[model samples]
Target: MPPQRATLLQVAQRAGVSRSTASFVLTGRHKDMRISEDARQRVLRAAQELDYRPNLMARSLRTKVTKTVALVSDTIASEAYAGRVIQGSLAAAVAHGHLLFIGETEGDPVVEEKLISDFLDRQVDGFLYASMFTRNIRLPKLLHGQKVVLLNCLTRGAHPAVVPDELTAGLDAARTLLDAGHRAGIYLVGHTRDQVFASRERLAGIKEGLGDAGVRLAGTIDCNWWPDSAYDAVCRALDDGLTPQALICLNDRVALGAYQALREAGLRIPDDVSVISFDDSDLAAWLRPQLTSIALPHYELGWRAIETLLGQPGEPAVQRLPMPVRRRASIGRPPAE
Candidate 1:
């Protein structure tokens, strides 16, 4: 037979206190009750000595609310960005004495729906949906009554959301390049006319920063957010006699690929063609000369998402958070002509 578990009554007996007093101390209610320090110590000592542990399930059932909240993400295993979001959310939840239930959907809405449905059946107290990439997302109707938070994306209606402020990112990047004495030939490598929220806002900030110095866009290229795609676009532009002294890639991966392409074309980073990009991914710092990139406030976004869910979800409004640019070895003054 298994050993018998210690009970609160046993702790009270050992501490020479009433069951109510023991309950107050063990449940951390002694502070509110103004219990004497000595008495509180006695209760704590007794609890530790007897190894008394309360049944969380019973406590939750009595309160009629599960202390668990579900965090749904598009793809958590992709890299540290998603993992960092989960880490931040869990840290906040744990501090609040709540349990976290994580769900990964791999960018599939069907998987997300199933996870939400299953969590609902289990009486989760709230929900958090973190998008892999920022975009407008339509939430499930079943989440109408439950507290929900959006991380990295926003809904159509008023909902609690936390996302990276791409406008700030752009400004930071431009400032970094300007500080390096780069006044002209700053090319922005980005998506086509269907600019996403991040891309559009970042571009606007970059332009605004350049405009402060009466500088204009040197050039622009529409490339898929992939290295090879950006490489091809840059190559074509170079062939067409577009002389870009600096390349601002939309992402680190694209910047890295552009580096390779430039090398093949007898160009060198910072020596011939400088480079910078958004998203300070691991690959950014690992490049040959290292890549200067924007730092998104990913952890803060995750923390805020969980905090908002703990409160009440309200009208969907966009909340812009500030981001900074990380200067690395990839950016420098234009080649001396």
Candidate 2:
């Protein structure tokens, strides 16, 4: 047999006070209820002795607030690199004394609709819609008139969103190379055109940074975010005698391929050419000459998304988290002619 859990009535009986007095003290509304300090202390001491905990579900019924939120995502929960978003959201939710429910749609509208309907039935306080990547999204019609914060994504209409500062990331990558004295032979690897939001913003930032330093891009090879494509591109470029002083890869995967190609050409990292990239994935540090890169700031994006949904002040209408540089062994001053 199991022992019964202590209740407010037991606490009140132990403290020689009414149940209402015990409730007021436990809820931090003793002063409002005209509860005396000595009586409040007695109730608190009694609660401690009895190990009494308030029933949150009963409290929710009285307050009409569920104290829970739902995180609806299009693959954020599944992708390894983007999983930090959920970690951030969960931390923030727990800190604020709220519960979080995560649901993955995998781009399936029917699944998303079911999740939304179920969350609504459970009376969640708000919704957090997130994406695995940065892009413009169209929210479900059912989400209108509901409190929602978009994460790692934006929409055509005005709604709160938290995304990475890709522009700054790009600018920082270029500035790092330029500041290291690499000038004339800087090449942008992968992401040929601006089809993706990150690619476009990062490229723009790179251009802006290079233009400010009075240098032009030596060339661009569109590898489309594939390691094999990047390997082929780098090999072809080197084979054609196009040796860049530095390479700014689009992501760590591209940089990995670039590393292989450079090794095959007998070019040592930072000895013959410097390398910088973005999306500071785990592979960055794993490389022999660790790659210097910009982080995606996925955790911060998810954390801020919850804060925005909870009506925290000073949150921007469209928050852009900074993509800080993770410097490693792959970057150095350009080699001498």
Candidate 3:
């Protein structure tokens, strides 16, 4: 009961050209085939009028290239900030004339296996293995030797990767406060864990940057990376008469907690204690005095990974995109002591 789809023969008949000519024109081989420009245009126009579309399935069977890519992620689609990552991937895929299919595995190995198997069965041209956060990830064994690009994550193996330069961002964070005349009473407002890639790299950059200036963090508040944990820790620190001139939080969420704690203790931001943080999320700008923080290049990570995968052939390389500093009202000169 369904109507038949328009055929290439119909387009060729309408354009008054041979089927081979029509095929060449539609498949972007007109120049190689030495077809006339007029004939190519006529075939294109006829295809448009008749709604004739080449069957990708048949073409892929012949070419052995699907011209499609799959993006497999662990809970990446669930986060709001990471939407830009998907956007970047989609844009680059479209630019390369490839279709992008996305699948979320929710960090479940069984689900991940099934999702990847399904994509493989469908003969996807390539894969983008992405993570919601930047960290070390063991790529799926199934993905080995396949055309793949790692997004926002890295591995020991040499698979092309694109991640935010968190280390540089950390160095910038420290320098931001130092440039504002903060030499002492500077405390870190989040716990640093070696297992976490961002934590270790950012902390190392901060240390190196501060050390370069012949200074160091006065103390650490040691709190979880969440607002509530940071709130309690900062509140305790303040109650114990910890008078920090400036606080460098590990993330925007931690900075939010520090802000609440500072306000409750009759301390004004950048007036009594300047504050700076990382991860320039939506919450960063929404703060009372917009928080000065380093931005995570979520969109660029996705875009660059896809480009690395599908762009000019090259050796597998890890690409760490720069994380820009988003300056705002939160940073100021340390209060006159």
Tens digits of per-residue lDDT, candidate 2, 151-209, equal: 88899888888999999998998899987998889999997566589999999999999
Candidate 3 segments exceeding 4 Å error: none
Residue 208 of model 2: what lDDT? 96
TM-score of every model versus the real structure? 0.90, 0.95, 0.97
Candidate number achieving the greatest lDDT relative to the actual structure: 3
Best by TM-score: 3
The digit string of per-residue lDDT tens for model 3 on 110-220 reads 999999999999899899999997889999999998999999889999888888888898899989988999988889989899999899999999998899999999999
lDDT of each: 0.83, 0.90, 0.91
Least accurate stretch of 10 residues (summed lDDT) in model 1? 311-320
Model 1 gets an lDDT of 0.83
Question: Compared with the true structure, what per-residue lDDT tens digits does model 1 show for residues 1-337?
Answer: 9789898889999999899999999888998988889999999999998888987788778997788899888885465655777778888898777899988888777887898899999889888877888888887887887778888988887777889898878877788888888889999886834338778888888889888888877878878888889889888888888878888888887897788878878888889888989988888889989888887777777777877778555534667777777778887777974
lDDT over C-alpha atoms for residue 91 of model 2: 94
Better of 2 and 3 by TM-score: 3
Clashing pairs in 1: 157-316, 158-315, 158-316, 159-315, 159-316
Clashing pairs in 2: none
